[model samples]
Target: MSSELLHDSGLIANPASTATLSDADADSLIAELALRGRAAQRVLAGMGEQVKADALRHAAAALRAAAPRVLAENARDLDKGRANGLAPAMLDRLKLDDARLDSIASALEAVANLPDPVGQVIDQRTVPTGLELSRVRVPIGLIGIIYESRPNVTADAAALCLRSGNAVLLRGGTEAVHSNHAIHAALVAGLEQAGVPADVVQLLPTQDRAAVGGMLRAAGLIDMIVPRGGKGLVARVQADARVPVLAHLDGICHTYVHSAADPVMARSVTLNAKMRRTGICGAMETLLIDASFPEASSVVAGLIDAGCELRGDARAQAIDPRIGKASAEDWDTEYLDSILSVAVVDGPEAALAHIARHSSGHTDAIITGDAAAAERFLTEVDSAIVMVNASTQFADGGEFGLGAEIGIATGRLHARGPVALEGLTTYKWQVRGTGQARA
Candidate 1:
C-alpha cells in the first residue's frame, strides 16, 4: 500500500518483463517473502521425496520452456553492460546464451535426480530410561543469497534452496537484475504449478543500496546470508549482517608445482585454471614453483608462452623480466582476470609457508607425483577445498557430485566447504523423554 507498491505495480504490467523494484516497496515485499518462505519450507520439509522430485522435474521443464525469454532478457543485460563499460571478464559472467540456459536447466534436472538430503536421520537411539534421541537433517528455514552478475545463479540458487526445503531470498547484482528477474519468473511459475509458494523463490524487487543493508540486517526475516561475489561485497555484507553468513570471501587461489611435478600436466592444468575462465572465483591467481625444480623455470616460461601476464617479486622477476615486477599486493591479490602472480619457493615447506601467509583459504591445488608431498599439501593447505594434480576450478560442488551449490563457504566454522543441499540445512535433535523426574 506504500508509494513504492504503486510504482512496482506499474512495472509489473508486462509480467514477462523486468524492471527495478523500488526501495519503498521492498520492505513489504521482503516481509511477504519471509512469511511465504517459512510456510513453503514447512510444506516442502513434509513433502515426500517423490513430490520434491516432481517439483524439481517441473521446474526443469519450466526453465526449458522459458529459455528463449531468459536469453532475451540476458541480451538486454549484456547490451547494458557493454554500454556501461563492464570489463570483459565481468561481462562474460553476466552474459547468458542458449547453451548456458540449457546447462542451468540440466542442473535442475540433476538436482531432481540426486538423493534427497532431507529426512536423513543421522543418529537414532533409545536410552535406558526410554528416552529416544535422534539427530535428523532439517531445512535451515529461510535463506538469503546475494550474488554477483550471473543470471544462471538465479535458477541454480532457487532450485537448490527449494529442493533442500529452504525458502530463498535472492539479491543479484544490479547489472543482471533484468535477467535474474526473468529467470525468477519461470521459477515462480514452476513453484506455483507445483503448489509451492511463489515467495519460496523470491527475488528482491528493488535494486536499492539500502535494500541490501535491510536484507543483511533482517535478522528475523532471514535465517542466514550467502554471499557469492567479490571480496568487497562479501566483506560489506559480513560487516553489516546481524544474521549468520555462509560466505566465500575471495578465491585468491593458487597452484603450487613441486620438484616432482609433471611439467606438462602442471602447465595444462594451470593454464586452464587461469585462462579457461579467468573471472570465476576458482581461477588460480598465483602460480608457485619450487626453487629446486629444474623444470620450474620451464613451467613459468610455458605459462608466459601461453599468454599469461605474470607478475613476480624481485627474486621471480630476476628469472624472467618479460613478466612484470610483482609487488607485495600481487602475492595477496585475487585478480579474477587474465593477470597471474608468480612466486618461487625452496620446497614444500616454503610453499606451505607462502600459502599460509597469503591464501584466502578458498581453493589451492598442488601438482606432484610424490604421494607424500601430495598428502602433505592436501593436509596442510588449510582451504575449504584442496586439490592434487587438478585445477582449483574443480573445487565447485557440481564437479564434486553436488547437483548444485548455493555458493562455496570459505568460513572456518560449521560450514567450510560447498554450500550444497546438505549445507542448506542444519541438524535438529528430536527427543522423546519418558516420565523421569529430576532428583
Candidate 2:
C-alpha cells in the first residue's frame, strides 16, 4: 500500500515506518504532532455526540472489514517476538487472533453506543448571586498514551478518547509494530469516512525509544499521560513525565478467602483469577487464605494441580509441602504469570494486614458468606476497585459495561478504577449571569 493512502491528513501516514533521529529531531516531531492533535481536538469537541458516535461505529466496521490484514500483521509481530525470546506471558499479551480481533471491534462498537459523556451537566443550580451555575463534563484534551505489548490498546484507547471528545497520540510498543500499523490504518479510514478529522487519533510514525522521552516532556501540549504496562514502565512514566500522569502501576491484586467462604467458590474464583489470561494486570497474584478455613489445604493443592507454581511463607508451606518458600520480595511481586504467592492468615485481621502492607491498590477481592466480613473488606481495602465474590479478572472497563477501557488507573485521582470514556473527561463550571456582579 502507498503511504499516501493515509497521507491526506496527519493520521499516521505509516506506522511501521521508523527513523534513526537525533534527539532534536524527535522533540521537533513530537511537538508538531501535539500541535496537530490539539487542532483536531478543538473540532471534535464541538461536534455533536451523535456524529462522534457514528464515526466510531464506522471505525468498528472498518476494523472488521480489515480483519485479514490485521491478523496477518499480528502474525508477523508474533514471529518477531518469538525470535527475540520474549517471555511467554508477554508474547500472549502481544499476540492477536481472529476471536480477539472480533472482541476489539465489538469493544469499539460498544463505545460508540455508550452515552456521550461530553457536555453533560453533572450539577446545576441557581446560586445566591442570581447566576445559573452548572458543572459540565468536558474532554481532557490531547492525551498521550504510552503502552506496551497490547496491540488492542491501539483501538480501545482511540475509541474512548474520541468518544469523550478528545484527541489522542498513541505510542505503542515496538513488539507489536506491524499489528499497530494495520489497526491504526483501519481506524483512521473509518473516522475520516464519517467526517471526523484524521488527526483526531494520531499514532507516532516511529517506534524509537527517544520518542517516549519527547512524549514525557510534552507538558503543555499533552494534557495527561496515561501509562498502561508493568511496574517498570509505569514507574518510568511517573518519574520522568512532565505531564500529569494517571498511572496504572503494578497490579499487585489480592484475593482473600475468609473462613466463612464456600469451598467451591474459593476454588473456582482462585483458579480462574490466576489462570485465565494471566498476562493481564487484573489477574490475581496473591492469595490470602484464612488459616481456619476448612478447605485451605485443598485450595493450595488445587492451584498446584492446575500447573500454577506457588510461593508461600512457612505457614503456607505447612499447608502443602509442594509449595515453595516465598521470599520477602514475593509478597510485593506482581507476577503476571501462572505463579502465585500464598499466605495463611489466622483470621480476617491478619489477611487485611497483609493486604495493606503489600497491595498495589489495583483491585482486591473477598470471598465470604458473611455479610459483615464482606462489607468490612469492601470498606477497608483502599484499592481502586474492591470486589465481593467475583474474580479479579472482572476488574475491566468492558466488564463494568463502559464498552472498553483506556486503562485501569491505580492512582487515586480524577480517573480511578477502570478508565472508560467517562474517565477520559473532566468538568468545567459554567455560570450564567446577567449583570450580576459579586455582591
Candidate 3:
C-alpha cells in the first residue's frame, strides 16, 4: 500500500519511509476501535460461556483447516528474515509448520475450555445504608501490543483478547511481518465468520520502527500498550509511550540451589531450566548454589553434561575447574543461548540478595528440600512469578492453565504475571439507583 492511501485512510500517516500512522490517523483508528470494543463487550457480556467456548472451538478448527495456506505464507517470512540477516533464534521463531499451527489451534481450544474471566464479580457488598457495591471483571476497552518475531503470539493474543471482549492492535516485529499478517487475516476471518467484529482484532499493517513510534504517541487512541520482547524494546517503549504500557521485559531468571536441596531434583530442574529452549525469555540465565552445599560440584558438572557451557566466578571455577571465569557483565546478562552462568553464595540469604540485585524480576525458582528456605524465597523474592520445585519454563500462562498468553508481564502494577483473558480486562463501577437522593 502507498503512503498516501494509508495516510488518507487515517490508518497510518506515511507508508513509504517510516510507515507510521499520524496522530490524526491514530485518533480515527482508536475511535473505530473503541466502538468495536464496546460492541464486542456488549455481545460477549450477554453470551453464555458455552457459546463463547463454541466460537473458540470453531476458530481453532478454522486455523487447522487453513494450515497449508498459512505455512506457505510463513515460509515467505522465514526467507525474508534470513535475507535481512535476522538471528537464527529469531528466524526459528518466525518459521511455522503444520505441527506449530496445530499447537496454536490446540491452544485456542484450551482457552475455550477455561472459565471466562469477564463480567464475573470478584467481590460484592452491601453497605449499612443499603447501597450495593461489587467489583467485576470488565474488558479494558482497547489494547496495543508491540511484540517480536513470534507468529504464535498473533493467534494467541487475538484469541485471549477476543475471548475477554477487548479490541487489540498488534504491531509485530518486521522479521515476521508476512507471517503475522497472514495469521491475523485468518483470525479476522474466523471472528467474522463467527459473527464477531473483525476490528476487535487488528494488525498495524506495516513493519517499520516509526510505526511503533506512532503507536507510542497514540495516547487517547490506545487504552494500554503491552510490549513483549527484549530489554531494549521494553525500555524504549516504556520511555516513549504516551499510554500506560504493560512491560514484559527480559527474563533474567535464576534458579538457586539451597544447602538442603536434593541433588537429583536440583540437577534435573537446573538443566531443564537452562537447556529447554534457551531462546525463550523464561529460560534460566543464571544458576546460584549454596557455598555450604556439599553437592554443588556435582550439580555444576551435571549442567555441563547437559551441554551447558559454564561461565562462573572464581569460587565456582574453583569447584568446577573446567568452567571459564565469569566476567562482571555475566551476572546481569540474560544469555538466551547454551551458556549458563554459575555462582556460589553462602546460603539462601545470599542467593536472594544476589538475585534481588540483578534479576529482571520476571521468574525465579528455588530447589530445596527445606520448607523454611522455600517459604522464605517465595515470600521474599519480588519476582512476578516464583516457583518452588518447577522449572522456570513454567512461567508461561498455558502452563498456569490460562490456555495461552500474550506474554509474561514483568511489571508489578495492574497486571503482573501472564497476560491472559483476565489480564486483558479492567474493572469499572456499575451503579443503578431508583430516584433516591444521597441526602
Candidate 4:
C-alpha cells in the first residue's frame, strides 16, 4: 500500500523522513501520541457494545484480506533477525506463517464474539437506609503495551482493548517493526470501516528504545502499562514505569510428578509440556519427581527420548546416567529452549517447597491421580496457573477460553494468568439515590 493509503487509514501521521531523530524528538512524538490516545479513549468508552464488537470483527476480516502484505513485511523482519544472529528460540517467536496468521485472525474473531465487559453489573445491593448500589465494569482508559518479537500481539492487544472499551498504544520490538506496521495498518482500516476512530489503536512510529522511556513516564496520560516479553524487558518496565503496570514476569514453570502419578500419564504430560513449542512462556522449564515414585526413571527417560536435554540434581542423575548435573541457577532459569531441569523431592510438601523457592509464579502443573495431593498442589503452589493432570503447555489464554492474551501475568494484585477482556477492565461504583441525604 502507498503512504497516502496508510495515512488515510489513520495508521500513520506523516510517513516521510525521520531516519535520524534525537531521544528528545522521540519523547515528543510519544507525548503527542499519548494525547491522541487519551482523546480516542474518551470516544471509545461511550461506544455501544455492538459498535466495539463490529470493529473487532472488521479488524479480523481485514487481517485475512491483507495477508499477503503482512507476510511480505514479516519476511523482511525474519531476514533481518537471521542477519542479526538472533537465537533459534527468538526466531521461532518472531516468525509468522500463513497458518499462524489465520490463527491470529481467528483469535480476533473469538474476542469479538465474547460478551463485552463494559458497563456490566458486577454486584448489586440495597442499603439499610434505602439506597440502590452497584459495582459496574468500566474502561481502563488508555493502555500502553510494550512487547517483544511477537507481531501477533499488535493485533491481539488492539482487539482486546477495543472490545473492552479501552484505547491502546502499542510499542513492539524493533525486530518486528515492519510486521507490526503492516498488521497495525490493517487493524486501523478495520476500525475506520466500523466507524470507530482509528486512533483507538496506535503504534509507535519509531523503534527507538527511548520511546519506551517516554511511555514509562506517561503517568498522567496512560492508565496502565503492560510489559509482555522476557525478564529484562519486564524488569525494566516494572522498575521504571511511573504509571500502574500489569507486569508479566518470567515463566519459570514447573511440572511435578507425585508418587500417585500414573507413569503413562506423567510421561505423556511431561513430554507435551516441555516439547510443544518451547518458545512460549508456558513451556515447562523444570521437572520435579517424587523420590519414592517407582516410575521416575521412566519419566526421565521419556523426556530425554523426546530430544530434551536434561540438567538434573544428584538424585535425578542417579536415576539416569546420561542426565547432566544441574547447576544452582538451572532451577530458577526460564529456558525458552529444549532444556529441562530435573529434581527429586520427598513428596508433595517437598515439591511445593522446591517450586516455591524456584518458581517464577507463572504456571505449574502436577501429574497425579490422588485427589488430596492434587488439591494441596493446586492450593499451595502459589502460581498464577496450577494445573492437575494436564500439560503446562495448556497454560494459554485460548486454552483457558479467553480467546487471546496480551500476556500471561505472574504478578499478584490486579491481574494474574492470561490477561484477556475482563483483565483489561476496572470497575466503578454506580449508585441510584432518591434525593436522600445521608446522616
Candidate 5:
C-alpha cells in the first residue's frame, strides 16, 4: 500500500511515467491497485469452491446479457483498427461477433464447471517423526496479466484467475481498450451481484504503457506477472519485471511431414494446421517435409489452393513455381498470417533437425503412418505441446479440456504448456504435529 515498500524490497522505484501521468500519480495508481487486489484476494481465497463456481456462472450470464453493448464496443475497436492501419491478422484477433461473444461467455461457464484447484491435496505423507504433512494447492494472490490485441484474453484470463481464486490486474493492449472496458463492466456487474468484491478483477484505467512498469516493479503486491503477447512485449516484460514472470513468447510453431507420412493425411493436416485461424498462437508457421515423403508437391499445392502464400527454400521452390523465395529470416519468423514458410529435408532426421533449429518451443507436430518415426519425433522434439499424426492447431487449453487457458507458457518453470486454472495456483506445505519440538 505504500510506495516506499518498493525501495524497502530492494527494488528501485522505476520512472514509470513520462508520457501520461506524473511519476507521483503513477505510483499512487499502482499503490491503490495493489491494496485493492491484495484485499480482494484474501477474501476470495477463503471462499468455498461452490461459491466461486456460482460467481463465475453469474459472470457468464452477465456477459451474455450484455452482448449488445459488448458488440457495439467491439465495433468501435474494429473501426479504429481499420483507420489506424492495423494488420489484418491483428484486427481479426481484436474483432468479436455474436458467436464469438457467446463463446467468450461460454468459456467462463466452462471454467466454472472445472474442478476447483485451490485446497486440493497435491501430496500427503506421514514422516518417521510422527508428523502428518500435506502439500495443498493455494491461490497465487494478485496476478497481473499483460497481454496484447486479443480481446478474448480479457474474458479468458479473468475467468481462469477467478476460478483459481486469485485476484487479477488486467492490462490489455490499447487496440481493444473499449471492448475490454465493456467486458470488464459486465464481469464486475456479475461479481457485485454475487456479493464478490469488484476488485477481484480490475482493468487498468490508463493505457499509457507506463503502468506496466509500475506493475512489474510492485514486488510485494503482485505475486506473478503473466505476459501474453508478441515477442517484443514478452521479451520486454521478462527483461524488465522485478517480479516473477510466466512468459508466453512468440509462437514460431512447426509442422513436419515425415518420410512415412500418408499423402492424404499430410495434405489435410498441414492445411488445417497452418490456416485454421492464422491469427492464433497455435497456428503452424513453418512446414518441414521429408524429401523421401511422396506428394510433397500436393501438400504444398493444397495449402496454395487454400489461398495461402508460400515462401519456400530452393528444393521447395522446385516443386511449385508459384512459391516465393524464403529468406534466412523466414525460418525464425512467426508468420501469424496466411503465409507459410516451406523447407524440404532429406529424411526424418533432417526434418527433426530443421524443427530443432527453428521452433520457438511452443507447439510442433509430426504427421506419419510409421509408429517408429512418429514415436521418435514425439520423443525428440522439445516443445511445450507435441503431437503425432495430428494438427498443431489442436494446441489449445480448451482443446486440452482444461476449460480455458490463461496463456500457453513457453517458459519451462512452474507452469508449462497450456496454463489453465491449475496452473494459476501454487502449493503450500501443511504440517500437523502435536508436542513436537526441534531438538
Candidate 6:
C-alpha cells in the first residue's frame, strides 16, 4: 500500500498542517489515532501466536522487498540533514543503507521466532479460601513511542509491540520523516497480506512538534510512552507526558578496571566499549582505573593509540601527558563520539563512589579477575545493567538474546534493561473459584 492509502485507511492521521496546528486539531488527530489503535489492539489480543508470527514473518519479507524504496527515502533525509548541518553522529544515526534495512528485517524475523510473551502464565496457585489465583501476561494496550533519528525504530518497535499483542503509535523525528513513512508503508502492506489490522502499527503523519504534545496529553488513550532519543527528548517526555513513560536516558556508562584486571583484557574490552559504534547508547562514556593497578598506563596507551580522544582528571592526566584535561562536567557527559573521559580511583570502593556520583544508571561494567571485587562492584552499582569481566558494549537486547529492543530502560520500576517482547507486556490476575466468601 502507498503511504497515502495507509493515511486514508485510518491507519494514520491525515497529514496535518506542517507549519502549525491548532490545539483542537492536534487533539482531534491524536484522539483519532488512539481510538484506531485501541481497536487494533483488541483485534491483536485475540490473535493466536501463529497468526502474529506469520504477520511478522510477512513484514520481514516486505521490508526486504521494499529495500530500494526505503534506501531512496533515507537518502533524501540524509541530504536534507547535511544541508541543515546535522552533526556527524546524528547523521550516522539518521542514515540507512541496504545493510541496515536487511538487519531490521532480520530482527523482525528473530522476534517472530521467539516464544510469544502474551498469555503466558507467570504464576498460579490455590489460595486457602479455595480460590485459584494466577497471573498471566497481557499487552499494555496502546503504546506511544516518540523517537528521534534511527528510522529502523519504526520497524523494531512495531514488530515487538505486535508480537506482544499491543498496538503501537510511532512519532519519529522530522529528520527521518520520509524514511519512516516509507518503512511504515511496507509494514502496513505486510499486515494486510497476513490478514492483520494495518492500524495495529501507525505513524503520526505530521512533523509538527505539537503532535508530540498531543501524544503526551493523550492520557487514557496511550497506556505508556517510550522515548528513544537524546537526553532532551527523553526529558521532555518524562516531564510533560500524562501517561506512564519508559525512559531511555543518557548512557553515561563507566568501565572500571580494577586492580585485579588483566592488562590485555582491559585494553581489548575498553577499546571495543568506547570505539565500537560510539553513537549507540551502550557505548562507554567514562573509564575508571584503580590507582593501585599497575597496568593502567597500558590500557590508556592503547585507547590513545586507537584514535580515541581521552579527557582525563588530574591524576589520569598525570599518568599520560598526552591525555587532555577533563572538566567535572565531562564525567557526566555522554559523548556519542570518539571522545572518552578517564579517571583514576583509589580502589573498588572509590570506583563505586565515582560511579554512584556520575553514572547515568544505564550500564556500568567492572573488568576484574577477582571474584570478590567483581561481585562487590556488581552489587554496589545501582544501574539497571551491571557487567563484570565483560565489555559494556554487550549491553544490548540482541546481544542479550532478546532479539531487538525498543530501548534500554534505565528506570527501576516495572521494566529495566533491554525492553524486548516481554517488556511490552503487563500481567493481570485471574481468579477462579467454585465458591468463595470473604470472612
Write model 3 residue lDDT over 1-439, tens digit each, in one string. 3445655654443212344556565455445544565566566667667766777777787788788888988888788778889876677667789888999989988888888888888888877667777888887777888898898998898888777877788888777776777777777777777776676777875565766776787777678898988778999999999999988888899999988989999888998999888889899999998987888878888888888899998899998778998999998998888888999999987998999999999999999999999999999999999999889988899888888998888877888888798888888765555555677
Where does the lowest 10-residue lDDT sum fall in candidate 3? Answer: 10-19
Stretches > 4 Å off in candidate 3: 1-4, 7-51, 432-435
TM-score versus the correct structure, for each prediction: 0.94, 0.96, 0.91, 0.95, 0.95, 0.96
For candidate 2, write residues 1-439 as lDDT tens digits. 1235335433354565555556766677788889999999999978998899999999999999999999999999999999999999999999888899999999898999999999899989997788899999999999999999899999999999999999999999989989998999999999999999999999888877778888999889999999888778888999999999998888899999999999999999999999988889999999999988999988888889999999999988999889999999999998899999999898989998999999999999999999999999999999999999999999999889888998888888888999998899999999898998674
lDDT of 6 at 266: 94
The candidate that achieves the highest lDDT relative to the unseen native structure: 6
List ranges where model 1 is wrong by over 4 Å: 1-26
Better of 3 and 4 by lDDT: 4
TM-score between candidate 4 and the true structure: 0.95
lDDT of 6 by residue, 274-362 (tens): 98888999999999999988988899999999889999989999988989999888998999999999999999889999999999999
Pitting candidate 2 against candidate 3, the one with the higher lDDT is 2
Report clashes for each candidate as comma-separated counts. Answer: 3, 0, 1, 0, 0, 0
- Which pairs in model 6 have colliding backbones? none
lDDT of each: 0.83, 0.91, 0.81, 0.89, 0.89, 0.91
Q: Write the per-residue lDDT of candidate 1 for residues 1-439, one digit (tens) a residue.
A: 2435635665344433344455544556666667777887777777778777777778888888998888888888899899999998899999888888889989988988888878799899998778899999988889998988988888889888888888888888988988988889887887788777676787776666666776876788899889888878999998888899887888899999898988788778888888888988899999998886667666777778877899987677877778898888888988878899998888999999999999999899999989999999999889999999998888788998998877888888767778788888889999888787656
Candidate 1's TM-score: 0.94
- Cα deviation in Å at residue 342, candidate 5? 0.5
Pairs with steric clashes in candidate 5: none
**Model 4 Cα lDDT, one tens digit per residue, 206-314:** 6657678888988888899999898899989989889999998888999999999999999999999999889999999999999878998889888898889999999
Estimate the overall C-alpha local distance difference test score of candidate 4: 0.89
Score residue 196 of candidate 3 by CA lDDT: 69
**TM-score of the candidate numbered 5?**
0.95
